[model samples]
Target: MSEKKNTNHGPQKGGPMGGFGAPVEKAKDFKGTIKKLLSYFKPNLVKVILVFVMAICSTIFSIAGPKIMGKATTKLYEGVYGKIALAKLNTQKVSLEKIASMSKTPNPKVSGGLAAIKAGIAKVISETGGKIDFTYIGHILLMVIGLYLVSALFTFVQQYVMAGIAQNIVYDMREDLSTKLNKLPLKYYDSKTHGEILSRVTNDMDNISTTLQQSLTQLVSSVVTILGVIIMMLTISPILTLVAIVTLPICGIATSGFAKKSQKYFAGQQKAIGELNGHVEEIYTGHNIVRVFGREQESIEKFEKINDELYEVGWKAQFISGIVMPVMNFINNVGYVVICVVGGMFVIKKKIEIGDIQAFIQYSKQFTMPIVQTANIANILQSTVASAERVFELLEEVEEIAEDKQPKVIELPKGEVKFEHVKFGYKENVTLIEDMNLEAKPGQTVAIVGPTGAGKTTLVNLLMRFYEINDGRITVDGVDTREMTRADLRGMFGMVLQDTWLFNGTIRDNIAYGRDNATEEDIINAAKAAHADHFIRTLPEGYDTILNEEASNISQGQKQLLTIARAILANPRILILDEATSSVDTRTEIFIQKAMGNLMKGRTSFVIAHRLSTIRDADVILVMRNGSVIEQGNHDELMKKNGFYADLYNSQFSDGEDVG
Candidate 1:
């Protein structure tokens, strides 16, 4: 397995940052969305509250720190402007004094007044250096530093809290989604692509996590910062603050305008991704078949086409979204220019002080900073919302069969099974099993035989309640099956499918899968009974050998036997053997058949057989044709009837293969 590296920059490796190309798609009902998102954090309300408070504090400090820096700049400039003003006044005084003294009869009044004013001006210039009160500059610097430190502390707290919340939310959502999947009606899977479903659970949820981790955090901080900055701006200069407010409309229009284009591309990208995943999944599972059929180039072409579509969507989305950040940055800079140029005139005219103008310039950024943050978070926001919708859609899917109003505990009495006038289909207005009826007594092995697509498997499906009957009912031990809980109903039967799916675990784990608490002795006995112990013993690791992905290390025949052993361990009251021996060779088939006979000794068994020789001794033979039972009786009775069953049996025997 390859290690997962951060691939945020690459197209194929979609990290949290990948979906920036897509803009926020217009989703109706913002209020409802907010409510739904909030519900995810309901359990951690205290943490959420604390995080919000911290965001507010952080915003206050962030806004205050910059304004304080501006204030210090303003103070320095005002002191220079004041000194220049005082020097000019003193120069005027000296010239007036010189003019008075030059008069033939010296005007003492003019001279004295000029001399006094000059003395005052000289004293002012001298005292400016000593007691000029520029020490406030140091205080302002400290204030800026203090605000920054406080903001940083609050930001740290907010980050840690929000991260914890986001992780917890993702964990809970995945666990809930998994549980819901297990409870979903089987037919939901039949009509849906596994890739699409997987995307919702994995990719979509991951998008939500990424959004929470970064964009959501920034969004909160931005709002708080904006609010705090606005308050400070209002306090500093109300008139200049009005000029700062104009930038908002421009930013909003720009963001919303670009977002529209981005969203369209994003939706397209998601669709393309789903299609790509579907194709990839199909190709991988059918790689061997593709090789046998020599369609490697064809598969590659299909993949390339899908990949190209994704690229187009991705490019368009990214291109549109990319403009937002730069554009917002530009607008923010323009807003700063406007504040500086316009506010400068006010300060020069003495309508506002230099400090007020400087503070207003910084506050303008505070006003536009939210817009910048929003632009940055836009991609994540869009993807997260889109992913959330998909996940909710899956959660809202209707189940195949509704649970009983009051389900009863199932108590099996001898394991007699009956299907009476049962009907089922994958969709409405179509029936796979119509008025089908069958009965199996305890310890009786009933074999159902038919050509492919004759609904032999459908019969087993109905018994398992994979689909609900449209017409009649199935019963276990004379009680209506629907009355029992689905889990309890399924617990009565053990099944071995044609295709066995194994998880990554040991051979012992696979065998014990049928019974959660199955003992070591039970596992070994089951394996021995299924005729799998001999082969298992010869293996280097025996029962301890681990399996990976469909038990690929083992042969198909071995997997089938392991399944059989699993069924034997479950020791269900009823059993379903669907092509149980199909994968095995002739030598293994005979031994497996004998082992199956032993397992079926005291269980009600339903066997769907392809080879006639395997079911020759079955108590009852059911011959089906196109979803209808054409003939049914004991093996001997069916042969005597000389109907579909008899013809099939004769054809099999006439072949070169001998049936002893």
Candidate 2:
């Protein structure tokens, strides 16, 4: 276990064992999954069939060579050596034949019956012109050559097909997962950890891909090869075949027992990784706070704890899985020894030839191989199923918000916005907006002012359809917001929030994000209007300057201004300014306010601000308290009422030190 101390602040390392939660205690969905997994090979069915055919051919040829050689041993022993021992019989046959023959003298050795039989066999051989017949040898060589070629060809084809299928399935899974993520609401992220989901999509999927490609293919080949070998062994000597089959139960018990320990440890390893990633993400994201609060050592201590725990889990899992291979191999070797001892006895008793014994030894290896392959395949199967369950868990996430079934398009002629007795909350039964009613006619600027958690931003979120209203209706141009497509409803407004989210792209690209096909002129004009063009031009690459993630290279004020420029480029009928000037200096705020003035012309706008001065010119100001409106009016109207809004205004604007 590596000490969890902050190890140079690099990304937490978990190469193969990165995922979340414990491994399953029992196999789930195995039957359905196997069917689905095999379906991927359906397209390559022809190639798979060819591979099986070639495997059988190779196995049969490999078995036949020794069988033929064993038969040849018996024939040679009887014909060559057996005949040499019959000298007396041959001498008697030769004397008889010589006395009987009148035309020519016969060899006295060939006179006897046994000698005559040997002479006749020798004459037949001699008639072939001393050319030894090698047809059987030629046939065996041809079979060997065919087996070699077919095995090589099929090996390539099967590997290629498996790799292709695995990659394709991985691609499809990634795409589907990504689409699901995009569709899920923002609330889903609020409850889940990013590291956990990232582990599933990347590490888990990769495990499945690698396992399916290698283990699955080898599994198929091993099964078919073992079956062919067993058939040959049975035909030759069923007793030896039975001896081979006895090794399987021992292997099954050994591997299955090891697998239980391996899975437990492996699952623990995955959980430890998720925790490590989550802690690392938190520390890095809050690095500044950790340093400011002087908690570096505390953070290091926590981090080291996770790292050390991961090491322990990893070692245990690897140790258990490692034991399986050697144990199975030992069992296989023992089986071979038993077969050898028994088969050698048979050979001495003349029950089987030496070649047959040799062939049986090879068959024993084939028989044990399938069991080994099955164990390995089972290991991979366990891992892939764990991964699949994670993937399915994500896919099964409850949808946060539903889309309109028959969404109506937003119309240009009617842009009236209204919140008619609307009620909402982030969580159920906890209302953030309760029976709230407000209206912003076309070309009117409505501002909302309140303290933190007073539901100001929550109201804006409802208008933007980021969350659903708990009660009452939100309408645009007299059409209920829920009846319109989220896209069309959102298209009616341009928003600039406090947290400026910028992708890695050029300055020109960020500004044009709202209007996809926005022209260069439109971008430049929008930037100029938002007072972002001067800073953008000062950059080394001018408008072409690319931004890193979240536009980290720029100042906070610069990012806000860029986001504002994006909204301006959108040219929406309604503008939403959410703390647009909060992170900027007074000078930048003045520039942003001026830009807002230009953008708000002829468009209904909603401004949610902590800075009280920004809302002084608003046509109407709404003060909220505890999910309901407390006061409503323009600045003067609210000031005269002398309630919460009046007190807020006095505190923010009292000695004329500009509120931000």
Candidate 3:
């Protein structure tokens, strides 16, 4: 066996919620993860369907709006420039198609242009008697304005309904994730950091929320606009429609290339950011240690390195994604030029009207925009799917072993506990505690002491059922602990650890947390028992003094006192005190020890202490080494035996060796 030391190795690995900076590991089952994410949409299916429908309606009106407005432009052009100009032409040998062709040529129109115009005027006079339509122009203008207004209203309705659906889905996700966190095993969290878990819950959920709110609608609108614009353009002129479609293949190739590069950079950028944030967290959490050691320069140097890496990846990711716009814009301009030239030829031939040519140009612009927005939305969805992967990972984490189907409750008994033939280890193929046996009768105080990692806390963890034993059985009042529900077994004990925990709430609330529905009187009495009431009363708000987020306003000793008060309020049949007075001053230590003694009266207790003196008065002392009990006796009895316990005890006083 390896020699044991009084040290903790710290926590293990775990999972996340999504944000921009999560590491770039591909989830094990990508398709399965997406399927799980989609399952959440089941409850909101109706609302989601409504959102898509509204989106389609909104996009259709917006697409048609540009074409409708072209009517006004055509009317003004024909009334002021075309009809009156045509009235002056004479019908000899002229045609508008031939005139348009000659306008683009060098010098062919010099002699025939005047005679051709006279011929066109003669033709127009025969058709309309040299009159121009003015009343029809005004009516078309009103209709165009009304189309724009309706389009605006549909878009508003679509967005409003989508907002509610997206937010509600996000709410359900957070709620479900919270429940999953509670159900996860202790070791799962032991493996990961707080920031990682928070990212999966907050950042990832936000990604999903934003995607549902915006991307879904954008996706629907992009499709509707693309199709609607194609049909509109075809009606005006098939040649122009073909010109517009020709650029799509070029855009597609460019888009595919940029997307691959951008996604690669995006993943790298997120990973670098995660590493940088981790460095910041580590530096800040150990800021005091850093100051004491004067390692500020080294810390700063480390930060700079990480920051430089982040800048490299972040710049590349952004640059790659941004290139998509300029590339697509170039392709669209190429198509636009072709369409305008072809449409002009059709107009002169009288194969299509000037109004139709204007409408087709507007349709072309509207169509190109949806393609751009859709491509951008594709990138957004990639990041969102990354977020969903995180949420899925968290939801899929392994939970604690199932509770007994026919469960027993810890009821109607004295506080007697027993551990028999227990064997366990944190990792498989290495048993730290093997075939161990122990007992604590009703009202007896059992103190377990050992070097760190010798399974001192591990024993308490087994008793609390935070971890399961590899073999044998633990019992409370002669009933096997495994048979009893975990909730019931845990409910019988009240524990106080070395580190105190207090939330952002009043002093009274922190104390009252030990018991459900505890009244003010119950809180006050528990505080008095733990000797925390006097200082609490001295505060500005007495028991109502609010603790800040970190509870840093109070001293360490005061926080310990509050935790003791919380335990006192619980008043459980079994008590476990773990170095409860380790960090306090000697005077506060005395008060804590006294409160602990009072608290232990008539209750079965287990004390895990580093200070041997604190456990000297324990009913039984179980000395542990490498996960086995090497000595078992009261203080005086162990002193007489003069073995391992003697060295441990004498080390504390003989030469002032820090046995603790």
Candidate 4:
């Protein structure tokens, strides 16, 4: 069945809405997945440490800014206030001197008060010269600016180093995924949709990359900022620091509540996106079929349904998560009011300076942001961990069975093959083929004919070891196929299936894909032999014409011919053709048959055909029914029997069928 038909279009089970909805994709083992993810950082440990140091330095420098700026404020205030005090004190000094001079018998109280007044006035005049001191404030401003510049410099360095670390780790992850994909068994591919597998490699990996590049460093900086701000606030006024902290529990409660509500919606959104992507990919690839069947409206309707669901969940997810910041800001603002009132009282009591009050308020504001950032990062980390777990799950999947430690070598393959007592099934306890025995001598053309799902393609799959048999062995040149490496075993055969596969590339490159290091002359010769050379010369670019992603530029018959050319270039000792000429017209089929005949001249060949007359000259013909061969003989012998083969052959021609 097509993968699209097999896809589950509905939401997944075990969601918050019971068993009928899409559940959030969470890490089954958060700690374990995080540990595995961290392993990727080992190679860049030094860089990670440096990033940490830089983050701390940057945050510390930034945290010190408001406190240092407070000094400038204090210096300016002192100058302005001192000048005003000096003027007031001069008047008082004159009055006190006049009173002292009038009281010839100096009163002790008057004498002490007058002397103290004169001392204060002199001190104020000396400090400010009865004017504001701009020089002192200028120095303080420069110092603050210098600290801010250094902070910015540290931030830039940390970000640059962190981006490199993130990319390197993602690069290694991508390489590992690529390698793992190649090593995985064919059954794995058969069981998964192309979109599902691609999502893990592409979407999941991208999520990890984004989180690492942005969120990871932000998490570190947010933490340091929070700690550093706390310390600075405490230094300014411990009472105000306590007031700022009292609001944290409320922020935490609000964030946790919103995150819990939005997380499931986020998961639903992701699931819906996957479904939408799968639907689009499937419909696009099979658009021609859909148009022919007139199902465009149906496809659009299905798309709308999925899209609507995505929109619903997306808004809910975004709305719930979005409110967190505003709500947090509101709570922090209330806390800000409380801190201001308390700091003002302390200032009036002379317990803290005016500059200290200003610094404390700045620190209080700074304190709330990192807490919010940390909460947001926590949520992002949850999603990131979920993505990481998916990647790790793929890496940990069971791979193909290991090759033989000391595999036997095939010096020169002659294409002799045998399947003895072969019992097999795609699943256990459901045998598709049982007690099958077959052999083909070197250079013999053996044809297999059968109804759909009659084990015809299954036979070829077994020969190539795309699947392993349940009980028995297949041998090539009298050596058990299992004894040889899969590469060596598969390398001996060339295949051209009913469904052609051609990658996007030039005609020359596509044909050359059949054999490594194939010369240009070899590619053209193979094309000529498959009768593809004529079509190649007819194109505007000839062999240089680039096929699009779907290879839709060429006719179906042309694609088949190109595949045949590729098989020809391979020049394998064994050839397997499963309805290789099914897509072509009679004339093209005849030409392909001729090319195939020449290609199969000295190689053992297995031809699987639906057309009864196509394999009339086979050395041996095997007719399969329901997983077993019901008839085995050549054309003349099978016709004499008037059994299944004869009946099938006669039916094809009985209704005035156009026999080519």
Candidate 5:
């Protein structure tokens, strides 16, 4: 056999940055992603509208406060103007008569205005015994305070409502994707790494949650503020409004140019993040192998490369979006300068009030502020849409070819099984298994012995429906397996693989996973039959001993025994042992073999073994090579023939070392 390189565990080879560098896509379908995202919020339609109202009311109230405050400024200025005697040089208490005589230009209006002011002051002094009337100013300040208070209340309500809505949508989306996972075909998961799938479920969902609550509401409020400010500015002076309008084109050019350039980078960032996650997950899960091979530094280097790529793209995307503010600030300064100059002229010409100019300046700031925000929000929307597109893409993946419209159920299954003219390949147009045929009679041990890459595991995968065969039929008890529900068909068989899989749970809980409703007595009996009861009793917590995250607390041999115990407890009608004793020590192999022997009694059993000594007693032996069964017979019969099986069996002991 040709030896392959040992570079499989690291980042993919022969690509930019060792394949960690992400590809760039042009014109991502943000519109479609956004439309699909809206559907998720449909269930909260009424609450969404209420949230919108809250935002609008909050913003409107706050927007109106500035105009009202401008009134207060106008009143205060006019009151001071009325009281001042600009021309009077000296006086004991300059009465209206002395000030009138001293003023040359103000004499015409001073008498009437001073009489009105004196009469108002006297009226207030008569009512409350005060020389000055502060009641009007107090009322205006109080009104402005009330408007702001209401605005604060609306803002609070908006956040509360939107938070619940966004979270619920997130929950529902996660729930849906999780449910879809169980229904998806084994091939779907086989093609995707755990980290890639997890990235979509966790990171993408969080993005949607944040953008839905913050960006969505920001978009709405900014839009409303822009429109309302425009109207207010126009009311003050259309000429100044035109001056502010000039900034729109500059903003459009900058935002559009940046958005188009940076949007792809943002999308690439999310994808790279997923790729980085996949790399981390793969390495961490196999950290033991990395240490054994002393490849820690190599792993770290690959990690740094991916991390650097992620940072590079992420920085560019964020920096490009960040430009919007400074660009708008420049635009806003120019726009405000023009509006201020024009409004100042209007005020001097007496065409607009000083109060109106003050309000318009505030309005102009308010208007451009939203324009800046809207542009910023637009860039955020691009990233958000990119994340949403990934989520929707997962949701759109073709689920396991749907179950039959009317799937049959095997109420009872016999152990007899057959595979006829089977054909399969992992990829299109590349055939792996062809014209395959096999059978296992009830109560017979069928041992499949094969060279490496001889398609033994692929055959088992096909039988279990992990992957559908390209052509041909698989049958159990003379009934086509496809006709029966996959769950019902699979429940009839138990599998103990070369790699032991025990989740984090108590010793009892992990064993009980095979048969959840099993009584304690049944569990103990199965453990005893597997010869695993002694170890269970020796543990500190006995059968209830809890396993750590990776079940690393126990020995590999012990874990294998527990799995054997589980299969025994399941009491399946058909048994499959795929190198089941591969992990166990020599002494423990005796117990595991005895247990497997008992479990296989009176059941159809298929033993896939590399050790010829282990399966010498099989009722039938099939020698396989290059995806086809080449020979089949009892051990003695195959040895007499001195064919492929004979040479394979004899080669193991060729050095007189009795290798199995």
Candidate 6:
């Protein structure tokens, strides 16, 4: 049980870094898992292509904004400088005119040359303006705004398309998983825990969904943004672009070192958390047993120990991962300073405009984020692929053997069961039941009595074909069980096991679960026949009462009665009652015994009971020991033979001991 629990409830694969502290679980076959995951998108290939196109368009539009906005800044700067130059030139023109007018018989040639130069300067000043070009700036601003709005629209479309594709693929995946679970053999479930299978279906599937919906789109946009920003930066100034690119290697080394260090702590934290959860689940579910054994304090101490370990590893993991962003930012800041200094030098040397420097700085800042995002996304993909691989593993599990294609149909099952030379085992080398043979006529009540693990229930399980026989044949109504479809063969019988299963619903619904299209009257009649109607009517809501998840609202005996009621409604040709009355009081047992007698009339019944007294009236008693029947006869005949059956019966009656 512990092994199964650990297999199922162990540390789950990590998701997108919850604060970059969760460990990323890598897939054993990364390329294979990726290929399989992509196959799921084949049906949505067109939509996927559309999403990529939209993402690229959106990113390209966004990348153009900084460069376009810089044009407006350039217009403003050129206007301001031109106005200053023009004003200075106007002052010089006035001084030149005054000198020419106040010549006092100056030379004519010199005066003519001065007049011509003054006229040319006046014409140049008039052709330009001493005020800023607000019109051009307004046009540039409008164009930038339009580009941003279009970018946002494209982003919305991209996300909308991608979301649909993700959900549809996940939907198909979940359907396939559900179907596969049903087709899996019982041995698979026997070797696994309910939690483990559920974790694969719920947690692992959710991880895949999250990655497809969010990370896939983000990865595309990040890559496009990186490429687009690089191009824009180079166009602005290749020298500044080179300066920004040089810092990347430093940032990469730092990030990789921190990620490796934090990964160890993150993995430790995850393990500790799983341990703590396991301890808490075990304690809470068995709290009564713990208290009865006086181990409450010990359990508490164990819980505290696990909790402390979790805290230690959790803090270290978070602290280490937390420093990565700050360190990367510092490196980026250094690169930004270098780019700005080079850009300023270019502007002063008249090699580049001030507005171009602004655009390049913006491009440089944009460049680093996508690179970081791509790295983070790469980590997220590792975890996502691991989840996908786990799910695929379950889907690829061995299913039950296929039913006969032309299966024989039993139109009216008579329930004459026979086992001939039957051999079986849970494992190949360890035989539990070997060469076992049994037979029951159409309407006989065959009682199977034995000690625990004596193959009493195994006999019934073989008769029902829950597990296939290793050798020989089992027949129902003179037809080989294997020749009939599993559904058709099992449909002829009704079972009430020791473990009563009741889902969360009304009592009426649970009883009616035995048959399709059962009317209210049919349900009430079955309940009355099982002797459960009286107690059920005494409840506050009677048949309308709702059962909780575990059906804990009802007593154990009441649960058994409900199950009997369900079997009674089924009214199958063969009835199996495996310790059905074990949980009830003696008085209730008598009621149940009478009900079983009535239900068994004209039907073949197999009763597996530990109490020898309960099956004395059965037509035949088969005493099983060591997976084989040691004796078989009626109660009186067995007593007369004075064999193993006789000793088992005498011991139970004389000492009031359950020989079963």
For TM-score, the strongest prediction is 6
Predicted candidate 6 versus true structure: per-residue lDDT over 216-318, tens digit per residue: 8899999999989988988888888888998999988887887788788887877787788778878888889999999988888988998899889888888
The better-scoring model by TM-score among 1 and 5 is: 1
**Candidate 1, residues 163-234: lDDT per residue as tens digits?**
999999999888878878977887889887766788788877887887787777688888777777778888
TM-score of each: 0.82, 0.79, 0.85, 0.88, 0.81, 0.92
What is the Å distance of residue 608 in model 3 from its true position? Answer: 0.4
lDDT of 2 at 419: 89
Query: In model 3, which regions exceed 4 Å deviation?
Result: 1-28, 86-135, 251-272, 305-324, 654-660
Tell me model 6's lDDT, rounded to 2 decimals. Answer: 0.86
- The RMSD of every model to the true structure, in order and in angstroms, is 5.3, 6.5, 7.6, 4.6, 6.7, 3.2
Model with the higher lDDT, candidate 4 or 5 = 4
Q: Tell me how many residue pairs clash in candidate 6.
A: 0
What do the candidate models score in CA lDDT, each in turn? 0.79, 0.75, 0.79, 0.86, 0.79, 0.86
Please give the range of 10 consecutive residues that has the lowest summed lDDT in model 5. 1-10
Question: Any runs in candidate 6 off by more than 4 Å, and if so which?
Answer: 1-22, 88-129, 654-660
In model 2, the number of clashes is 11
Clashing pairs in 4: none
Q: How many backbone clashes does candidate 1 have?
A: 4
Q: Report the poorest 10 consecutive residues by lDDT, candidate 2.
A: 5-14
Error (Å) of candidate 5 at residue 435 is 2.4
Better structure of 3 and 4 per lDDT: 4
Clashing pairs in 5: none
Query: Which is better, 5 or 6, measured by lDDT?
Result: 6
User: Candidate 1: global Cα-lDDT?
Assistant: 0.79
Please report, as a residue range, the 10-residue window in candidate 3 with the lowest summed lDDT: 8-17
Model 2 earns a TM-score of: 0.79
Which tens-of-lDDT digit does each residue in 265-348 have in candidate 2? 876776777679778878888899999999899889988998999999988777766676688789889988998999989988
Higher TM-score: candidate 1 or 6? Answer: 6
Model 1 TM-score, all chains together: 0.82
